[model samples]
Target: MSALTGTTRLARLVLRRDRIRLAIWILGTPLLGYALAGSVASIYPGQEARLGYATTSASSLVARAFNGPIHGTDLGAVVVAETYVTLALIVALLSTFAVTRHTRQNEETGRAELLGANVVGRYAPLTAALLVIVAANTLAAVLLAVALAGAGLPLAGSVAAAAAIGGVGVAFTAIAAVTAQLSVTARGANALAAATVGLAFVLRAAGDVLGEQSADGTRVRSAWPSWISPLGWGNQVRAFDGERWWVLALPVALLLVGVALAYALAERRDQGAGLIAPRRGPATAAPRLLSPAGLAWRMQRGTLLGWAVGVAVLGFSMGIAGDEFNDMIDANPAAAEAINAMGGGADLINAYLAAMLGLFALTIGAYVVQALLRVRGDEADGVLEAALATAVSRTRWLGTQVLAATLGAVALLLVAGVTTGLGYGIVTGDPLGQAVELGGAALLRLPALLVIAGVVTAIFGLLPRWSVVLSWTALLVFLLLGQLGAVLELPQAALNVSPYTHVPAVPAVDPAALPLVVLAAVAAALLAVGVAAFRHRDVPS
Candidate 1:
């Protein structure tokens, strides 16, 4: 039999397994750009507004660091500038997760071994996964092009923008493939691949921030750092301003090299093992590992720590940007007005801080879902069932996960709040005071995070089969409503459905007591119902 035997059948099986997931990535990735395209007209209406945006954004280090360099004054260029980094990150994530799920995860679960006993080739699973991701990225690119064109952008620039996004996806698919070959566990592969994506973003940001501004102050020529990142290559495509078709060659080359390296490395390693072996663990279990709570903590602590570090970085960066907001507002009053509208406070600095805090809340909410889903994984893998056979009760097992998730989220918030305050306070010469105030603001976001946790727990108990998909869908809906509701011009009634919509933008305005109380009580009810249901229902044997 040929080495590539049964590849097509494995590809079909992957498609069948991940249909919903693929659909979400393909559709949702494009929709983000379309929504931003539709809103850009209102956000920056005329040429003057667009020019103002280009100039201000191009000149602001904070803007450049976060969004990349602005290309030109055209509305299409503005759309690319606004959405490129965000959409590229999403696409990259979609690619990594899809690849790792089908390859490393399959190996970890012994599915690949079972298939290997048949006529399946050594590279069949990896090949099938990459093919699926390529198809998904192609469909997303086409749909995104159509969406942007429908939003009134020129067709050619839209296609270029879509292609840029797709390139990032392709490049990261290769990166994940390599990481899959290198890491023994699926989680380690995912983390390694994701950290690479994060590194790309940072490199792109650094390049843009350190680059030279153009004569009109509406464009920046990025430094050498950008040339090394896939994101930088995508940005260099310059979707609207003189679309550089050649820059795409970089990612295509990276994809080829990465895939070749992956396959070669795979041949050297034994099946279900990685080139980089995991560190040896202690022979005996720790005393803490005796309980369900302890086991859950051991499984989840690494994830929590990763999130905490990321939050700290974000908070500190935003805190430092706090000092820059005044200069940004002074240079462009129109932009200041936009910030005020989004943040809802008269004081520009406070408004900016409040907006950053909301972002912190969203991050915490996502972390909560991820942590809870790990518990779902335990249940799905029958690990929870084994634990239950012992003296451990169902409530203690499920409740421990919930409690750990809650406390972990709280710790992240505290990290975010303090780091943000510390960063700002150091710049303003009042570190202690700012830390206290910002830390409180971060804590205020806890109720919304809890509401999200409760919903996920309830789903886990009531609809275990749909728990993963439904939980993510819920979080995505909340993110859309909370972040884009105003931009999308949705009705207040519709926006009210998100728990985050009720959380007051603290420091911007004094928060009312009633909304926080209502959200907390609702969260409590959901947690109670979920726990009760899990106790009574039969575990999926």
Candidate 2:
């Protein structure tokens, strides 16, 4: 039998298994583009208005770093400026997760092994996963091009942008395949792949920031940095600036390189093994490991470290750019107006900081949910039954895990505040005051974070089977409303559905404690009910 003999069957099986998942990922970017295109057109109103906004943005340090060069003053280009970077990230992440799920994840769960024992070929799983991603990404590109054109953008530019966006997905899909062959477990593979995506973002940002126009409007380091990164290549598509069709060639080359490397690595490894060896564990358990809480900490410590480092780096990087961003805004009245408008027009830095703080809390909330969901995985693996066979009650066993997650959240929250503040302080020479102010901003998110944790806890206790899907969906909803809804000018009632809507935007508002109290009360109620439910449920419940 050939190594790819069963690839077509496996590819169909993958599509069948992930039909809904694939549809959701493919449709999402187009919908987001539509919403953003409509909003930018409506909000900016006229050509002069849009151009002025672009000029000021092009001159700002932070804007350029985050959004890349504004190719033109046209609304279509403005849409690219605002949505391309965000959309690229979404597609890359979707590609990464999809490939990981079908490849390394299936292997870890023993599904691939079972299939291998049958008629499947050696390379069928990987070949099938790649084919599925290619089809899905192509579908997404066509949909987004149509959606953008429908939203009143130039058809050619829209199609070009969609291709560029899809290119990001293709490149990441291949990268994930490479990562899948390198790590011993799905979790390790995902961590490595996610870190690569993040580094791509950083490289793009650094390249763009260094390349922003000088005071007199001359170009500066952008070409070298951008040329080195696939994410940056998407921006070079320059959709509205006569469309740089050649830039689309870059990701194609990367896809070939990544695919070749992944295939080579996969061929060298066994069905259930990876090119990288696993780390050795200690021969004996420490005293702390004897307790459930200690065990929970041990399980989650590595995850916490990764999140901590990533967030800290982001905060510090933002801080480093703060002074230049503010100074540029001050020098350009048009830029200041736009920045103020986006931030509700008061202490732009603080307002921006507060928004980031809230979003960071959401990231921590996501961590909390992931930590709790691990319990479900353990239960399914019969780890829960084995542990429960001892003195550990279900409540005690789960409670320790919950407590560990909460502590991790608190730690992340603090880190976000300190790093952002430290960055701002270094720029403004007001370290102490910045720390106090920004640290308080982090504290303000406690209630909302707790609410998310409690709601996820209830889902886990009451609906373990649906916990993973429902919990993640809740976070996605909140993110869409808070980030994209504001841009789309969504109805106030719809926006109010997110708990973060009520969390004071800080520095913009003094932040009332009543809302916090009510949110905490709600969280407590949910947690209590969940605990009670778990108490009466069967083992593995």
Residues 318-395 of candidate 1 have per-residue lDDT tens digits of 998898788667655666666665567798898888888887888788899999998778887788788999999998
Model 2 misplaced regions, further than 4 Å = 212-221, 320-349, 538-541
Give the whole-model CA lDDT for all candidates, comma-separated: 0.88, 0.81
The per-candidate count of clashes, in order, stands at 0, 0
Measured against the true structure, the TM-scores of the candidates, in listed sequence, are: 0.97, 0.91
Off by over 4 Å in 1: 331-334
Evaluate residue 149 in candidate 1 and report its C-alpha lDDT on the 0 to 100 scale. 94
Could you say which candidate leads in lDDT? 1
TM-score, candidate number 1: 0.97
